[model samples]
Target chain A: MNKSLNIDAQTVSVEANKTVEANNTVQAEKRLPGDLAMWFFILAELTVFAVLFIGFAVSEQLNVEMFVQGKAKLHQISGLINTLTLITSSFFVALALTQMHQGNGKQAAKLLVVAKLVACIYISVKIWEYLSLFEQGIDIETNTFFTLYFMITFFHLMHILLGMVILFFVAIKAAKNEYNASNISGFESGASYWHMVDLLWIILFPLIYVI
Target chain B: MQSTNANKKNTLSWLWLLILTVISTYIGSFLELFNTQKSLFIIIVLFIVFLKGQQIIDIFMELKKAPKLWRRLLFAYVILLPVIIGLIYLL
Candidate 1:
């Protein structure tokens, strides 16, 4: 009888240790989650956007009146909607990453699906906004604002499309239970990219639409 | 990851981002109202943008606990861009 109790106690202790170790593994200690190469890529991308952003600001400075007039024609409502949409998508992706870290791969996959759905809203709104501008005969060559507007926003749209594709593959892998607490680097890399897309649009909304 | 705490913080960050975005949009909507204090208004909007950018960097990007170098690089971008724009607009 004593032997059986001793065996059960040892089993319980070993199980507790495993749980603690699993939890600790999920909690990173002052480290980056994604690939170092992805960080370099992000820096490079930010540099390009920086130059484009600076150019737009300087051009607006050259002729504030023209820029303001150009801004008036852009759809503010659509801009606001897109900003909210991307931010929401990013939020979902963040949660999904957290879930993945906790070994909840299926739940994380579901969150990414939700993130992709929100991304689709952004795509739909953006395409509609573009078509509306076209309807109003406001192509890039129409003026300096339109030029920068089309160039900057279209560039951003392309990134969003790419991000969606990445998220799609990530979601599929996640649903397959491919990533777990210890092996989430690839998933983290994809999520970081999506957040970057969201980050760019946060700045772009005010730069292009409101400010 | 202490998921419950992490989730709570993320939800809070999302709420803050939502509030800040709406506030900036509302402020920018009042063209005539802000016409007189255009420079001041631009400054305020940039400040709000800074807040939103910080939230994105630290919360959504999950860079707060990252190495100081990486966090500072991204934060610098957020700071410099708005400052440059605000300076141009003010000028």
Candidate 2:
């Protein structure tokens, strides 16, 4: 009877400790249930991309020759390079999650910073590519293909910018040690969104430029 | 203990996703099979995407371990929302 009473006391202490720890965690991390929100947002954003894609498909049907011609005019190498950058960034963010899981918040923050840098490189090169095409006499009004090209790629760049912003915030939180494995949802969601951004580029690179 | 479990889950899911990303990118590039057969390529790519995406949503987002209603709501968002949007686009 005494031993059972002792065991009950131990269990009570453990439960109390758990509750205290949970409370401390909530205070320290303040991570809103960010994953569901991010996923739903991604789903909505993908829909927008799909609509634009459908627009492109319909337009392509109307003007296949123009698409072929525009594909010829744009620099495929730049598109490929941009795709590589985004892919590398996606991998970096994935590694960031691993770093956080390992309790290396500073390292995870650094990875996110590096990811953001890669995103900046992607955006810069994309803008330069667009401007160069314009200086070379390409315009959105030039043809149906150019219209879809600028529209879709511009929307994509905006998403990249938005993603970089989210990464920046998550990086700051990680550096503050508020994004360890217990509350890594923000980091994970940011990485997922970045992956989606990268995935879109992967599809767009070949579709818009190659075939 | 909970944190450790979360860590293991994150690492496993991240690895799965990286492999998926690499494979899909290669598939998109190499398969000019889509050139001659547009709808077929779309179907295959979309299927692969849905698989990868559902995994990410389920694992990384913790939907698989969530309550039944939470999972149902997420499934509704994933499945129904896209269909609604696509129909709007079609119109």
Candidate 3:
């Protein structure tokens, strides 16, 4: 009987170890919130922005007076408004992800719609700011400062547009209950991209408009 | 249950972000009006940008729960650029 008991104890220890290993696997899988591909894209996009920002800084150093004057001509209040709008949109996107995780796909879709609407407002404000600048004869080729400003902001605007397209598809899928807690990679990927847009704006707003 | 907890945490993070943005705007305006301590104000603004970027990465992007390498990459992106910008301005 003692021999049988020893064998049983060994079997239980092995089973326990197996269980622990399985749990670790699950935890490891859970650590990455979204698609690996999206993270790669984010890294690449950030690198481009970093390069552009460095170039802007170098150009600013060369023509501090022009940069300062160009900056003064910018509508600071409008930039501030756009900053707030993007932040609000990002907040909604986060909420949409949360709702998706909770298996509330319809709510998630609605939240994404709100995010898109706010993004539209941002685009509108940006256009208005650009138009006002044009009225003041501040086109892209006017100076180095204007060139950099137009390039960076317009490039960022293109990202926002692309993000909107991604959000459109994600929202449609989410509305159809395509994403749930167990399967939300697409939703997370789209949200991640949108947040990158906001993150870049958060940095850009200060770098160009305020500082 | 987990979703609810995550939602609360995200909402709190968003609130913190909004507050920081408001404070930064106020500081920006103040710097514009006063025009003294320009370097200090710029540093403060960049620091706020860094903090906001960190919050977005950690909370919204959910990188806080990610692997060490992923988190480090993002943290480096957020911190390094601003530090470089600050150094450029200061020097």
Q: Write candidate 2's Cα lDDT for A90-204 as tens digits.
A: 7677667767878889998998898888878888899899889889999889877888899899989989998888888989989999966567777778877877786566546
lDDT of 1 by residue, A1-211 (tens): 9999999999999999999998677555668869999989988888898888889989998988999899888889999999999989999999999899888889999999999999899999999998998999889899888999999999999999999898899999999999977789899999999998888888788888887
Give me the candidate number with maximum TM-score.
3
On DockQ, who's better, 1 or 3?
1
Model 2 CAPRI quality: incorrect
Off by over 4 Å in 2: A1-34, B1-91
Looking at model 3, give its docking quality level: medium
Listed in order, the DockQ scores are: 0.69, 0.17, 0.65
Q: Rank by TM-score, highest first.
A: 3, 1, 2
How accurate locally is residue A6 in candidate 3, as Cα lDDT from 0 to 100? 100
Query: Between which residue pairs do clashes occur in model 3?
Result: none
Candidate 2, residues B32-52, lDDT tens digits: the string is 555666444444544444555
Candidate 2 chain A has its poorest 10 consecutive residues by lDDT at A25-34
Provide all candidates' interface root-mean-square deviations.
0.9, 6.1, 1.6
Collision count for each candidate, in order: 0, 0, 0
* Candidate with more favorable, higher lDDT: 2 or 3: 3
Give the per-residue lDDT of model 1 (tens digit) for B6-25.
Answer: 89889999999999999999
